[model samples]
Target chain A: AQTVTQSQPEMSVQEAETVTLSCTYDTSESDYYLFWYKQPPSRQMILVIRQEAYKQQNATENRFSVNFQKAAKSFSLKISDSQLGDAAMYFCAYIGNSGYALNFGKGTSLLVTP
Target chain B: EAGVAQSPRYKIIEKRQSVAFWCNPISGHATLYWYQQILGQGPKLLIQFQNNGVVDDSQLPKDRFSAERLKGVDSTLKIQPAKLEDSAVYLCASSPLPVPVYEQYFGPGTRLTVT
Candidate 1:
């Protein structure tokens, strides 16, 4: 079974600053996908970014980027120039190439302060 | 395009009572998923459906839980004689394709409180 682990329970960053959230997973499958999702108080899970394990290059979307180290099974999300809207529960998820179901890690609550 | 839709937004029920939640996936989506998220924890996949057929229900407690995607568009999950442990948010998501190539759009979850 594949399991995702988010070590940080909570994180804080000043507005306009940068923060990195750590995530690691255990998987035997060579082909898989990693994702970061943000859930606001509204309870809607929004996709923040995603990375394909086979791709050596990391993935980035606007201010959100991932440092994906496939050999170490570590996928960390980096948020640059953080804003107040970045306050939310962030989850790291994993899904194998042959499977559709996502395995999510316990979220890390982020707080962006002015 | 509209995202996944789920209702009722909130539900309160006592132990031993039965409750049901509904979900409507985005049009043309070939896959839908149901997940249970306990407070302070990540969402756990309870079931997955490819159209109207069940693809996975390994984590779902079949003894008291039942789900159906009758028309391949709308789905319902029911809990009979609910337990206190069933208190959590139920999330519904849909993807145009079963592969991870397509993003899974999630709905505002239905929060269930079992007292």
Candidate 2:
């Protein structure tokens, strides 16, 4: 079984500043996928960014990026130029090739202060 | 162009009562998932289907919960005799089957409260 751990329960960042959320996972498989999802108060879950385990380079999507360390099983999210709209709950998830279900972390609430 | 669709945005039921939730995945998507999100926790997978076939259901509580995706389109999840612990936001997600990138498109979720 794979387990995702986000040590930080809550994180606050000033608008326009940068913030990094930590995540780590335990997986015996060599190839897998890592994802970051944002759930706002609207109750909608949105995909932030994703990283493939086989890729050495990190994944970037405009303001969101991920540092994926395959050997360490660590995948972290970095939000650059954080805005007020970034306030939401961020979750780290993992899914293996054998299945479609995701193993997710407890989630870290992000607060972007203006 | 529409995303995933879910019915009964909110549900309130008493314990020992049966309740069901419905989900309609995105068009052309062959995979669907049901998740339970607690108050302060991330969504937990309840069941997953790949075109009407059960792909993964290890975390699902089969004794009290049941789900079906007949004809591989829409899906329904039922909880027979609800429990307090079952109170949570139920989320549904879908993705194209056999796609190299298995990114899940999520729905707003159905909030269920068992009093």
Best by DockQ: 1
Displacement of residue B67 (Cα, Å) in model 2 is: 0.9
TM-score of each: 0.98, 0.96
Model 1 native-contact share:
0.85
Lowest summed lDDT over 10 consecutive residues: which window, candidate 1 chain A? A40-49
- For model 2 chain B, the run of ten residues with the poorest summed lDDT: B96-105
Tell me, per candidate, how large a share of the native contacts it keeps.
0.85, 0.75
Clashing pairs in 1: none
Off by over 4 Å in 2: B98-100
Candidate 1 lDDT over B67-114, as tens digits, reads: 999989999999998999999999999998775899999999999999
Error of 1 at A38 (Å): 0.5
Model 2 backbone overlap count: 0
CAPRI-style quality class for the chain A–B interface of candidate 1? high
